[model samples]
Target chain A: MNISIKRKDQGDHRFLVAVSGEIDVFTAPELQKGLLPLTEIRGGTLILDLNETRYMDSTALGVIVAALKSASRHQCSFSVTGMTPRIQRLFEITGLMELLKRVQTSRGVAND
Target chain B: METQEDESQLSEYRTLLAHYISQKDQKLPTEESEHLRRQLHACGILPEDLLGLHIEALKGAGIFSESAMMRSLNFLMKMMSGYSKAYREHQELKDWQKQLDTELDIASALQKTLLDGKVPACSFADIGAISEPAKRMSGDYYRIVNDGKRLVVTIADIVGKGIPAAMCMSMIKYAMDSLPENSQGAPSYILSLLNRVVERNVDTNMFITMFYGVYDPETGIFSNSSAGHEPGFYYSAREDRFMDLEARGLSLGLAREAEYKEYARRIYSGDMIFLLTDGVTEIRKDHDFIEREQIVALIRRWMHLPAAEIVKQVMRALKKMQDFSLQDDFTFIAIKF
Candidate 1:
């Protein structure tokens, strides 16, 4: 599957990464490469938007967890928004829902 | 220097130079050119100076007039650009290959440890199983649990292959081991418990097809349930016929309230139960899948042998038909009563 990543600077040490398509074995590496660097920025807020993601595997979940860990070590805030029900179910099943911060986006409001 | 003879010689030299340059093939230099340039630099001779001297020689020979010099310079520039682009692409490919190799090594190590679990021993039935992964990791898993009075057999195939499926299989093994002691003998109940665990622990995008069976030697009864797994075949020595042990259930991790129905059958001495993942039956010969009846026939032919030998012979036969390398993970279990 293909994974397209778009990075948006939200000003004041915050970044938004909108990821689309499937995050599977073939595509997780691309996603990891894009998100891991953002987590290293100190005291930054990294938001991952997965509203258009069609699917995610355990490896993808592992990558997300790694990003969260890196963010925590750098004293940065990390959250994921616009999770489809399928992706949300994956997070729940793998017990990663507790580790990852989930944000709700109402209409066109920015994910804070 | 002011001789007409010298001028005529220079003109002749220019004609000769142009003829040679036009006749020789022009090809872009490869990475070896970089090594040559480095060697030149180490020898106190700059590569740019070397090129400048050659250009001057060509100009003095009258082979490189203003337009000709520009054409040669442009060709050199394009050659350098092409070489650098090729070098970068080569390095990127090497890096990607190295990364994939490391990942496969880690995945293979993890899969080896999980697949090497001890097989349970039974007095009345002899069991043997083998799993061969198509890649560095496998999606197929099998476990045997003997609680002295009864034997529980489970064989499952996850949706995908490689590291992700291996991770899921490892989780399934742990979940199966953690089932309640009271739920050991009920095939349907054990599958239900396993389904719940998978639903809670595995990704929804992935699912597992499993066959869970519990055999009681004391009562000569075998109860089995499937979660979208292939139907195994049972050879009845008394009736001299083979029957499929069919059960209805959805694949695990499909839903929270998935239900599995169990089927029970009496076992007789000299009977054989054969179970396998799709890898065995799905073997492609020419363009069509190997017939299920062929698998059943093979089992029947080897029914008299020990379980281990039977499985070995069947695998040998499958390899003969499929050229010794399957496209997916191949797992098979044979139990002789």
Candidate 2:
């Protein structure tokens, strides 16, 4: 499966990147590469969109965990948006929901 | 190296990307937008590919604005990476399965070679032997050697099971090969040599039960000795009955100088001699022993059958009694004169 990245401005220091695909061991590195730079910059919030993701495995879970650590180190808040039930359940199984902020849609950031 | 922290960071970042991509008109600060623009560019999707179609899409939607192109690009990069991870995992699983299948094939071939041996011919005897090792390997072996005037026949079963027993059986075959050409002189003499060979090399817990004999096909007379093996059966079509031959020696590998009693039998046409391991009569049926009655019943039915057919029938009956599962290696050898 191929993943696509879309960028958008979410307020003054928050950038949103939407992701869609089946995330697993093969594609996790691509997800990691896309998020590593933003966390390096240390301030902008990254809103990850996973609503279109139909399935994910343990390696995909690893990618998500890596992104969370990078954000915390940079002191930038990380939020998940547009989580489909499948993605939501994965996050629940991995206990990722407990550690990261989650929202129904990226649209809320614009009003803020 | 920083796997733990990197994983945590990746999760946090994905959460934001999830949020960012869903926003229809989200605006990032100028610096943040540029940073995300570069991240998307690194994924091999040019900024224009993400933006070109979205620019028209935004204008047509009426809710579209200048920031639409950047948001679209960021979303596309996340999708590509997610797909890459899935592809790699599928390949890994396929490779692992292939490796497992190859190993299983090699193990099967090695087991077959260790259990089967070449059959030697004798002028006066027509010998037939067969062994089945269930699902895994087992310790059932039979050998026939033509020693000039006498035909030497040996059938043995190693105690215990699996690959270990098969290994010990191989060692025993090698020990037999080392014996003198005229070694069938006496049962006790041969057993003394065999016991010394086994006890010197094998673990104390390992042992073997064997029935060895010499036959003069010209005279139709057989002389034999047993080392803790099951009593053999001699079937006479003329008499229409089966007689049990005594097993008159201690098991091999237990002690040196083990005594064995010699027995002789004269055979006529339509006379049959059968040698069996415990796995035959010891077959379990409804949690009860199959015993001598069932065995005699089977032999009576197939007394006139060919040697192969007789062995096959016994195996079939044993399988039926064990509910189609043969838990041990079942081996038998038969000679007709």
Highest lDDT: give the candidate number.
Answer: 1
TM-score of chain B of each: 0.75, 0.67
How do the residues B1-337 of candidate 1 rate in per-residue lDDT, one tens digit apiece?
5456435443543443354345435432435434443443454544455455345437744544565565455433532343465568989999999999998898788778877745677888899888888787898999887888888888998866677788899999888767777465477877888888887887545678799998888898999988877778888888898887766676676556766788999999988788888678667676456788999888878877888888889988987787888766889999888
For all the predictions, what are the DockQ values?
Answer: 0.03, 0.01
TM-score of each: 0.59, 0.52
- Model 1: runs farther than 4 Å from truth? A1-112, B1-81, B181-185
- For model 2, what is the alpha-carbon lDDT of residue A46? 81
Q: Write the per-residue lDDT of candidate 2 for residues B165-185, one digit (tens) a residue.
A: 778888988888788767646
For each candidate, report what fraction of the true interface contacts it reproduces. 0.00, 0.00
Best by TM-score: 1
| lDDT score, candidate 2 | 0.66
